[model samples]
Target: MKEISTLRLAKELERSERTIFTVKELTSQIKDLLENRFLLVWVEGEISQLKNHDSGHIFFSLKDEEALLKVIMFRERARELPFPLREGLQVLCFGRISVYPPRGEYRLIVQRIEPRGLGSLQLAFEALKRELAARGYFDEARKKSLPAYPERVAVVTSISGAALHDFLRVARERWQAEILIYPVRVQGEGAAEDIARAIDNLNRMKDLDLIVITRGGGSLEDLWAFNERIVAEAVFRSRIPVVSAVGHEVDYTICDFVADLRAPTPTAAAQQIFPDRKQLIEDLDFRRRRLFELISERLRKLERELHHLSKRLKSPEKLIQETGERVQDLEARLRKALAHQFFLKENRFRNLVRHLEAVSPLAVLSRGYSVTRKLPEKIVIRKAREVRTGEFVEILLEEGRLEARVERIHPDNHLF
Candidate 1:
């Protein structure tokens, strides 16, 4: 009876095969049936045989211990992956079935792929954080130091948020710095970009000493702007020192790591950056009082010293007597100096006079020598021939001048 049934089924199969469809038609029909039956289905499996093509399409196989399903995510859909795809990674995929007519194979057309244990956004955040950290963006060495006293502070936050109000309230009471608000979206789409742009714009102002980036506490999705790479990079590149005050004290974000300073809250940032005016006044008063006391003490000490010195001092008459005695002693020294100088000058003068007397011609004349000169010519008779036998000559002697005639001219040829 089973063989007779099998034969009847075979004849029915042969009849259906006589009107068989082409490969394309068959694949299209199967694709349509499977896609329609499993539209927008969730599939959880481990990825295997993954291939990321140059065209940005990802082709892989999702498998389990029992079976495997071929998956293909096109470029447009694959671009939305928050994390990198790899073989043997367990994932949850949402897509519909699709067929390749040429290959006659049906594949799961994936729209989105997420890691099994973590949310997509969280995975993206971690991925971006790792990338930035590897590039030294989160290095503490790159961070700038905040000004000791910032006079102009720029607050980048949502104008409608309570953060601004809290910051302003604390700032106004604490310090006299001018607050400039750069209003931007703190949540939702484009919030990260808005924050980055605001930071860049605030940096263009040379007068801005501090940039405080802040937002109120919220869910991870709402606080994602502070975690974005755009905002982190902006904080890192800012010329002015940046202060990140986002969410509550327990919260942390990428901006907090890259910023020059990280405050727990907006109010905390205000208090940390600004000095308390009352405390400053009190400190100034304390220092001023200290300085005045020191000066007064010094003056009092000087007065005491003066009094002590005055007590040890002599009377005016005694002072005058001492001064007079000093003057008399100085006068005696002056007279002694003058007498010594006069004795030295007298010796020098006497030596000069003796030298002059030794060189004088009258000294030679005193030794019985005379100077004779021919009369009328007044030439000195140095040679006998200088005077004729009858020429009158004058003889210069030590006592007087004598006039005489040349009586004899003795020829001294033999002596020459």
Candidate 2:
């Protein structure tokens, strides 16, 4: 298709010789007409010789496994490229198909070219880097400490990553908390969109006290997925706190800046958010033991002080002198109270004994009743055969107890 257009276009330009023309004039006309003719066609190929020119225009070749085409984009379009153009990368350029008469070679005038696998990530990185840098991730002061005792935590990462398992282990072991997962892909084409969606989902869950965005360590290109603008903005604008743990400690990305905290690894991130439950239990046990010891020591001190006070108390001589003065008064009061109290005691004594016996549990056994207790198991023997062989039994009969070992028992065969 390109070949046919090229042959026809060449002859059309050559026939224009009836009009006066210089070489420069012909090149300009060719450039203008070809540029106007084909606008925004999708060309898929591999980048072969990619170079950024001094004027900022990009010159490159797009080749497949079979053939190649020359491509050029002016500085304006070149500057907006999704990723750094490089040789050996597969790409799709949106551009006008054209011919340069001076070179007489067909070319693609690239408006914007996206690297097949790397474009979205590269675009995301560029966008997020710009925004977060403005918001101060690169700022040394903005980084904050991770939660040390998060009770409710959320994880935003692929449910399949080893990082998920690693983080879960650390969180459960350390905090024994309720962990909520807002799972998503951590890297690849739509990874940024997925991450942003997960963040948004977690934001609506009010009980989530902290969010952990993490993935296992990977190379720079792999980690670039986390550096996207939507993902970064999601972290920054989260209502609940966020902890970015995208890769290894050294692997920093845009999400790290916007997050409230940044952990070195997924496991490290979980550890940072969670307080060690075992350690907390140990601390509580120590405090309880200390309290018990303090109470025991105080009781001992009080007992010792009472004994010492008792020793200092004057007893016999002082009591005798005190009693003499009270004796005359007591004799006078007794004469008056004797008539009333002595008559009441005889009647009240029998009643008091009856009341005490009524309240006692043993009173039931004295009235032609015997209490039976079960052997070894200590169940009360409400029926005769409750005890098994080799069992010892106790019989309660009022004031005395009888112990007996089980003998062969017989049962009535008749239905009752």
> Which numbered prediction scores highest in TM-score against the true structure?
1
- Tens digit of per-residue lDDT, candidate 2, span 352-397: 9999999776888877687778765656786556667778888888
lDDT per model, in order?
Answer: 0.87, 0.78
Model 2 weakest lDDT span, ten residues long: 119-128
Which candidate number maximizes lDDT? 1
Model 1 C-alpha lDDT per residue in residues 38-110, reported as the tens digit of each score: 8888898988999999999999999999989999999987764545676667788988877777887777889
Off by over 4 Å in 2: 1-134, 137-148, 298-416
Return the number of clashes found in candidate 2.
0
TM-score of 2: 0.47
TM-score of 1: 0.62
Runs off by more than 4 Å, candidate 1: 1-152, 160-162, 176-180, 204-209, 218-220, 312-321, 351-359, 373-394, 402-416
Model 1, global lDDT? 0.87
TM-score of each model, in listed order: 0.62, 0.47
